[model samples]
Target: MAKGDDLDPKGLIEESYKIEGISTAECRSIFLDWALSYQGVSAVGIAALLARHGLGTDHHPMTITLREGLLAPHAPKRRGGRRGRVVD
Candidate 1:
């Protein structure tokens, strides 16, 4: 059996704050939007996030990836290899 209880956005935001690639504010805002929009699909669950994404949004949202011109914070920590290494 599963326990159905209230969800806390602040708690989740605090936890996500330790992670890279996003700030706590963005994480929290995105999460809240997901929660409010995906009402019937078990709020605060990972499944809800997928469902919300599939439904789409008003904003022209793009991923925080190379295509969007956002370099990942941890990307530079890795040693360059011959595959895509810069050379003079």
Candidate 2:
């Protein structure tokens, strides 16, 4: 096993989300996608996170991650230059 596999799970999950090319929104999205990508969180585990978020099994959906919430309008804006900063 990799050195990190033995780490505390919360720390490992946080570290995995920090790996290069893994953005916060992608991490949030993959929390759902994770169901398919690997052995994945247990059905019980998925149920727990969903319940913690007040998501009903029947209809609630994942909200945008913090970064996505901040950046959505910028999806159409040009990259680079000084306009990047949100003005007061």
Query: In candidate 2, which residue ranges exceed 4 Å CA deviation?
Result: 1-8, 11-29, 32-41, 55-88
Candidate 1 similarity to native, TM-score: 0.26
For model 2, how does the per-residue alpha-carbon lDDT over 1-88 read when each residue is reduced to its tens digit? 2332222233333344336655555556655344444353354544444444433322222322422323335457566767766665
In model 1, what lDDT does residue 26 have? 71
Which residue ranges in model 1 land beyond 4 Å of their true spot? 1-20, 41-44, 47-88
TM-score of each: 0.26, 0.25
Our model 1 lands, by Cα RMSD against the true structure, at 12.1
Candidate 2 lDDT (Cα, 0 to 1): 0.41
Across 2-86, the per-residue lDDT of candidate 1 in tens digits comes to: 3233342334422343346564357556555545644354323543333333234223232221112222245556566885586
